[model samples]
Target: MFKSSHLPLEHADKKSWASGGASSSSPMEYPTPLNFYEKPPMFDVKLEQFEQSALDRLRILAEIESCSARGRPWDETKRIVSTLCQKHLRLSSNTAGGDLGIMDTQKEDERRKDHLSHFVLRLAFCRTEDLRQRFITAESTLFRCRFEEATPAERTLLYESRDFKWVKVDDVEKKSLEANLRATLTGFKNIAEQNDAWDRDAFYKVQWSQVPQLVEHRRVFLKKGWAYVPARQQSAIVFREFEVHLRQALNMTNRAMPQMDEDTRLTPIIDHLSQGFLAGVASDWQYEEGDDTTKLRAEQVDEYAKKHWPLCMRSIHDQLKKDHHVKHYGRLYYTLFLKGMKLDINEAIAFWKKSFQGGKVTEDKFNKEYRYNIRHTYGQEGKRANYQAKTCVALLTGDAEYGCPYRFLAPESLQTRLQISYADQGLQSSDIHEILNNKKGSHFNIACTRVFEITHAKYVKKGEGLGQSETVTHPNLYAERSIEFETKKEGPTKVTSKQEDDDLEGIIMQVD
Candidate 1:
């Protein structure tokens, strides 16, 4: 009954044809477009149900975040989610439940439902109760400290000396403070552009500087007041307590509330808004490859599905491979999602066509250049452009699991990373020169994100010999390029939020 605007043929209509044993040889017919030649963007989530589904999926993601971050392993969480998918989300099983082996009689008409009733109970066993108790104690202390910091000051000083009644001289911090302001501005901008998914209004409003203010101008009431030390810290404290309550609520409804952030201006909003989306994407109808051959009995199918469940979700399994690339994971996960969405190759082509609007490609041009490319990528009789399309979609979706799509580097950070890499590796200037100047030699930032792709090389044995290994590639081998400087000893020690520290404390408590 649920029909996407991009593909409005009813499920019943689809099922009718499917029941009659439709195959690629005997495909069901549908309407031809009036102007496929005009080349409009092929796909849009035109259906309200689709948007609602996206939102519903986001809600479930919040639940997953709250649950998994508390102590649950991704494997366990994924398994439960996979089970839910099989029961309700009606994707047919072709081979066995865990893999797509030689296509064995595909089952049509089965849809999986998300009945997440036991999500909370599972989370309860995810960690020991003792660990929960210690987390409560530590987080309680943090909550108290944060709250105390937010308390109103005992004395309030009015900035109204008769001579300076219009404004307070006390607020005149030196221009040097501009550096801090700039850093804050830049940090917020980077986060918003890269991570935050919600609309701009949710985070902040930029204001232009206005000079020569007139008296009694209500809009320009920039007050000069010192923030009391105690009160200044309480905002984060208050929000953190709220986070704990969310954890305790356990039920999905409580999880759906937007996460609270500590910064009044930006960081909190950016993290939560994007995380809300990330979580949403995580919770959409669980997808798994399953084989349900009629040759196998119902019990046999169930056993098979359970036994090979991990393989069916190979997107998760490939993480263990030495040469596992994050982009590949991003591509794999996204491709499967598109496939699960029931988007046919032609429909997918249409979607990409729309995505590249305002480009040089008209319909005819796109068809000649990229149309077959997308088709072939999605396992259709098209070309390799489909594979390239997956990468583009991954970049658009902001799955940093594959690395940043946009080239986001603060020049200073890049410079520092380059210096560090060279110094740490003891590479002489001549060595650097050789890499830069040699036409055949390549320059590699040991910290570059592309290192993930080379991990597949791990499985290949080194040299012409039988089995001597060379180097093992892992996450650590790819250095973090972001420069982190040590703050002055007198400066505040870095403090992580209760949400982050809870897991550590819980682990310790469990051990105790």
Candidate 2:
């Protein structure tokens, strides 16, 4: 539970958050590395902090889903998830680091963020059945990830903090179950080869149904209806318990959500976070010209679109090449994405002018019809709104010609492009089938992320973990990540990181 250090429970109001004047009087305690998120924090959060915390947590969970989708080994998954947690959800133990006073403050702050973010995401994800299931799986996996890294003392602290109610297998019962335990020790070759440190091995008895994963994997010694889970495999029980509690909590949150619908200030952020998760890369961070890695030229559009563009932009590029014209929305879509790719206004005008000229448009006509809108998109005209590239979420509801190909293109057309057209840079036949399966399930962005990885395989080194940046939420993000991964050899991985900026006025997040 979060300490009421920042706000008094009686006077806790959303007004204080809007004014940003809350102060901490006392410190909070996290006590344990793992959390069940069983209690909702009563503290207030500023709008920005609320949004940022949910986004940070969402990134970690999104990466967790990606790891399983990609079939990463547990060690690799843990390593990748651990690194991501350090960045977004670091829950460092009390004994390992320096300066207890300062470090404890930071750790408690991190835990506070963790607690609130979990509940915030609950509110965001509880709106739909799919969302609830996803939240349960991701949150449970996150708990398991942390539990695995917890020290023995930290584990003890966790048991003290929460009543998991798992019964310990006493030494008498342990000896009685020795034959069954050895029988289920499938991970080992023979009983004689097993270690002699019998006193060190610990076991807990739980209902067999509580940990079907351990039972199915033969990792636990089962008798009658009880599964005796070893200390080393306790995560299975913990994960199952976390998942069960979360599923029930989501239902409760959903039933209590009517009041939330009236809070217009919060619902949009919640919806935004939900949409980002569905898109497989939840972020509100806007990109800027300063974030661009390459000085893209007009001549490079064709080559780059062929080599580096995601399916959405690549499909649009293909349309422009074939017809020398795209409809209004299609042109707008391509222009904004190109702008995000850091194609200078002059080069953008040049690229469009040349492509359109090949069909019906003369220079004068191109200047009159297309050039101003391109300039308008670049913030040189109209309201100077500086429209952003349509994210994967936005693309789903936008024009089919300009939208994500996975969502818009016919199954036959998508298969042709993936298997026949982009196969050189994209997926193998089996990879195409797997991605198409995701597409069938309406996980369009996940399918796009899969395509991006396959096509850009040369840029990705081993252990190139998936993070928000690597997931294809926006067409520009796809291009940016492609460029970043290709060029970066040894620097810290910006491979899955997004650029943060205040220029979100142009953010095109209005999706259904």
Candidate 3:
């Protein structure tokens, strides 16, 4: 069993099999400290973009490895690549062919070429110029032809003939690579066993993709089934060069491609990715429920949600309750929260999208309808409204995938619910009108009405038919006191209630 940061010290019990690694003095150095309320460093959106882009690149690279351009086994290789690209990256057979230059303009034979071309472009370049150069110059011999037609020996020969090189590692680099690989394998096992949405097949696929990188880093570079003689350290040189190129490509994507208004670009992608990951996790969360690490009993979920409902998912929950609608915003919020709390991204996404199964809405319809609403809730474009939710997930749970910075307790009210703290200053009375002056003749009142609906089953009281309730019937009082008595402070010698009530007729009663 791999060690967990949350597990209590084993000395408290005698059956301690796990070793506690070196204890650290600093809090940040540890994995998950309980009270991790540091200002979240600016989110690494670039990193996420980089990882996704790399996966796109890998799908094509794998195809190239499988197919050789020597023109022998092209037909069989083409079929394999078609399936792989379509399954993973949604590229069609014609598109894959267009990519490899087997044909042009996406014909029946050319569909594979087109799909492969797009994947390669996404992999190697941030701009069209680099993409053109890479496509034109990439080694044709590296493309795969057929897997079964050739024996392992023949396949190895073909791989060697392609300009693609693999090298044997020296003792030092081999040890380092092996250690890293071990840790990665262990991490994968832990996550898989937690089983929060990671299926065995999908888990294996992701793990397999990392193999080529590991192998290249470890083995000596191959030329003709023999080690290529480079003067000092050519393998390291090649690896470093590849990483540098990839980093630059990723940086360019961040700077140039996602340059639309925060609402238009980053928000939609974030919402989609977040929901995708959450749905994936929720589907798998139950798989490990009885395991040692996961004590998440099914029965406890409903109770936990009830007690924590107000604060559990403050922003999205409130939005859903009031609007009687949950679109993109609700999905993104819940998904991210799950991710922050250590659920796998794929599982989280699958779970959420699946949750909508009982509803009439299809996934596409749901995304189209709700995508923008979520982005708006995050205040992604810097527009500050009275009810706007904060963008930080960690504020709620210190887990980026699941933080909720806007929860508050209102158990005294029947509609006990979470809310973004607005302007409660502990003062009582009619000073509310003056305090809410900026909110006058605006949607702030409407926002308050919405909040009520969210906390209670209905924000507005139900009526016989359509129209809204009377103004006096609305629950939100702009201020507890009138503007005239805004300065009236309670003193030891305060006037009696009867006297104050009698004198109050002379106060300024400017009702809007």
RMSD of each: 27.5, 5.1, 28.2
lDDT of candidate 1 over 1-512, digit per residue (tens): 01122223222323332223224343212111000011111222223322233234333333333333333464544544444334433233222243232221132112111111112112221134442343343223323332332213211211111111122112234132423322322224465552332122111111212111211222222223321111222233234333444346433322332321222332332233333332122211222223432122322222322222111122222331223222334434333334333345555565445534554446786677555434444555422222211221122234444422112233354344334333433334433333222111111111121122122223222120111211111111111110011111232112222111011111111100
- lDDT of candidate 2 over 310-338, digit per residue (tens): 87888879889999988776777777778
In model 3, which range of ten residues has the least summed lDDT? Answer: 278-287
Consecutive 10-residue window with the lowest summed lDDT within model 1: 31-40
Best candidate (score: lDDT): 2
User: Per-residue lDDT tens digits of candidate 3, residues 1-512?
Assistant: 00111112222334211122122232212121111111211211233332344344344433343232212265655565545545544322222343333222222212222322333233234335533233322222112222232344434443343333344445454344443323333233465563432222111111212234434654323323443222122223333333444444444443544433233333443333222221110110111112334232323323323322323354444444344345433454454333322234334444444555556557886566543333332223225221212122122223333332222222222122222322232222332342233123222222232333323322223220001221111111111111112334332111111110011111212111
Per-model C-alpha lDDT, please? 0.27, 0.72, 0.30
Model 2: lowest-lDDT 10 consecutive positions: 503-512
At residue 446, candidate 3 shows an lDDT of 27
TM-score, predicted candidate 1 vs. hidden true structure: 0.18
Give me the displacement of residue 289 in model 1, in angstroms.
Answer: 11
- TM-score for candidate 3: 0.22
